[model samples]
Target: MDFDTIRNHYGILIVLSTFISRIIFNGFCWSYGTVIVQLKKQHLNISDTELSLIGSIGQSFGGLLAPLILFLARRYGYQLTFICSLLTCVISLFISSLIHNLHWLLITYSLPYGFANAAIFILGTLICGHYYPVNQHIKHISIMCIISTGFPIGYHIMSAWVFSSIEKNEWQIMKRHLAFIELIATCILGPIFTMKYSSNIPLEYQRPSITVTQNNNNRKSRFSLPIIVWLIGIFTTMSAVNNFLLHLESYLKYLGFASARADLWFRLHGLFDALFRLSIPLFIHLYPVNIIYLFPTCVFTGFIFLLLVFGLLYTSINALAILPIVLFSFTSAVTTSLQYTVSNQLFDKDETEQGYIYHVIITSLGLILGPIIGGSFLDLTGNYKSIMLISLMFLLISFISFSLTILLSNKKEDTHQSEQN
Candidate 1:
């Protein structure tokens, strides 16, 4: 193929490679849930709490390492960062298969693998920045949303398929397969991603505009009001979702819903979440939204439906509660799925990597704090409604933060336009 033809298709190739990377990352990360079932059945002696530590530790370390991951990626460049991290993930998974002991597996299997996932994931965003010029990054968000859906796809579908029909005694085999799948996927995309970073690129390929470069020079402007507010918005949004999902089944049981019915909606939430993420490019195509405003609009809409669901629960109108739940699920899905895109718009094109790194770091807090706060409220008040209230509280805060982001982002845009004129 000619250079222009390869250049023309390079963006799609990058999206596809990143998409596959996301699938492998989440597929392996969440495989622990399925792995736990077999583990519990086999060990019989291990407490659920102890078994739970495996996934939790992995996720915690995975998320907490974002800053360091950024440091390395920036220092070593994407080519080395992606390859080394991918290898680390594959090797960790392979080593995990050899150890049957839960304690060692906690350290051996999940921790390094999770860190590698974070490195690959963070670097993926940075590398994609190279392909799409800074001005066009907003458009990049569309494909990125398509890519983001890979998480749910992995969580809901890939993990199950990996374990499907495997004997209870064969989980070691499952880990090996997970390693192989990731390794193979990396190999397939290695050439494409290799061309994406570090070597053959022009020096002036991705320099930021003078205005944005000026803004970046000031650390305070880098963390300007709008961006800080958006950070707050993301934190609350994630906390609310995690808080709600962590206890949804229990809350339904407390409200007298059948176990089977609750399971259906709970699973439906994930299914619908993925579907909505898939629909994002179409939604953008039809609506032509300015993501600056759309981001807040979505969070607000979701907050409204979520509140309606809570109201239905309190009014003894539980029959219609699931309706709002489904609607909330849609908005929740869109907001979370488009978050990375929205974050891209929050900063100058050249500064997006730092913005994204901060975005991931803040999100990890929501993940940890959400469940803890929800569980605490439930335990303290002996009321499941308390959990709902906490979720609502965070959701509302997220909406407000996003709205403020809209106002501040617009103000910054207006200022820049005025200065140019």
Candidate 2:
């Protein structure tokens, strides 16, 4: 077959690579809370608060470093870097299985695993962007959503399997099983497919003609103006706020909910998050992209839902708690997915690596800060109500920020059309 035909067939490989890679990463991502429990059990001297702190530290490190990994991928080949990341996680998992001390776990496994998780999260999106055409971004992102949604499912399965095995005194077997699965799925598949599909042409050659750099000095001047910076701040805060909802399960359990019920609520949140993420492309097709308004607007409403949940607004049924989780998760997926799509479109295809990196830096900022801010506040009050309110305020700011971005983009488009006329 001709090269175009080969590329067409290669799309399946792209999807498969993404699917397996996500599953491996998802295993680690969702395993945090479950493993935190195990660590507590293994080190009985460690307090619950201390375990939460360790997890927070690990996640904070991961979020902060995620963009740096993508930056390195820009210099080195993403294909090579991604493969190395997968292997790193595999090695970490194996070593973690052999150790018992908390300090040793933090240094050898926790730190490396944090890097592994960050690399996977950022590179998954980068790979999807690399292989797919700009027009196909939404479709491709939808596929990513489907694969990513399986993360929570994997989390539950792994948690159950590990806990059950440990109960049966089969810790070694379970650890080895997880290690082999992550290794084969990510370390093996990534290099083979990436080497096969990654382009030989450098990213600079194919990027968009317009650049943030050209606008950088102008952008800096503009930043001094309050409105533009305000918008960026609002957008950043909104991103962070939405992220807070993702960790609600831990927050709720800390608030006195039963562990089983809390986990169930968390999964329910994922189900909604996944469904909304998966459906967005279809929704974008049926409705104007402006229909994105509904998501943030619902977010504004969901804050009220949180208050109700926290203040005994409802009967306190298990299903009732699931409501806010569902709403927040759904909105989170929309914003997260939309941010990637919008960033991909901002520059020409040739500049996507930089564009993707730039947008992700914006995303990474929120990821790094959200937990620190939210977790600190939760610790201070032991009540999530204040945090929910803070999140609600940020969502409002985000709504305004997005609205302004749309306005600015529209103005630019109009000016270009008039110039052509």
Candidate 3:
């Protein structure tokens, strides 16, 4: 089919593409924590600390290697790269099911799985940017976000079932069962969703800069160390926020709230996440286009939320515990939408997709650090306050880093325009 045919049926095609990919991405998001527990259980020698280290290793590698994968997607079509990534994850998960040895598990299963997760992140963003109209960029991203919520949502539900099965059956058997189920799901759905549209061009046609010429590729050299540092710091802050949100239940209980009541607060957190995902675009239309100012405002508000959560330990507000948690959810939603939107503004059309891959990898690494460090602080001091403090520091750093990114971005833009003159 020609571009016109696909464009004529754009609505249906975009929806299908977004839905399947988002479902797959969110499934892995949920699987991240699930695998941590399973890996620990399967390996007798791996302590909680070691498990954390393993996760960190996977995260770091994924962040660093994501650019290369994005480069590949820029060569092959996005659709093909996405299918390959889904298949790769299924294969890794299957191998993980069979591997009893720790060394083999880490080398083959865990590391690859982590890398595959990075691939999915790249694929999802690129696919969205490639297939949808550029003018509708934020709308498409928000639509994906709407679909992406299914990832965490499905993860929670499916993991519950998996855990129940794990309790009843041997670990190996449970692993095999889940693996086959995932494999079948990917094998059937991956091909169907990917091949549906024939007009999809090779990555070369889509993004020729990477291989266009040596000089052209030079323009795409990696960011400077200082910039990389800034990106990493922003990622670390986002990671801390992710950790606090994920562990809000334990944080509340530590602050003297009842387990049931604390759990209720967490459910509300999920509700706000879904609501924010749905609502951000609506709000985005009304917001000023001052990406510079608006982006920092999100950082500031999110930072304040982090502080409130941390302060709760000392103040222990029984009447208003729910408010900060709600703010946390809102902040995550807004920050997430803004992150993509700001990233969209920062890079050109050709550069935006790959930049997104880099961003996700960095952000995922931050996520890895957040929980590991948060858990350590809790285990060492028997308090959640330290975690909150760490989160606050990370967010402050993010606020600064984002400010620098904008400054650097604007300076670069001005320099380019002057040279053109």
How far out, in Å, is residue 168 in model 2?
5.2
Q: For each candidate, what TM-score against the reference?
A: 0.77, 0.79, 0.76
List lDDT for all candidates, in order.
0.69, 0.59, 0.60
Per-residue lDDT of model 1, residues 187-286, tens digit only:
7766667544332342332347557656547577567888788889888887787667656655676787865576556556656677777777777778
How many Å off is the CA of 290 in candidate 3? 4.2
Per model, state how many residue pairs clash. 0, 5, 3
TM-score of 1: 0.77
lDDT of 3 by residue, 1-421 (tens): 8766775376455456555554544444443444555555566565444455455544344556776786776666566776776776677767776766766766765577667766765565555455553467566655656655554444444445555666578655765676677677666655544424534443453435455575355355446543574576568666766667545554565567764465456556655666766776666667635544555666778888767655654664555756776777665665554455455555555455555666776777776777677767766775667667777877788778777766776787799999999
Model 2 scores worst on lDDT over the 10 consecutive residues at: 221-230
The numbered model that scores best in lDDT is 1
Query: What is the lDDT ranking, best to worst?
Result: 1, 3, 2
Task: List candidate 1 segments past 4 Å from native.
Answer: 30-57, 94-106, 137-139, 162-176, 196-217, 246-267, 307-326, 376-386, 409-421
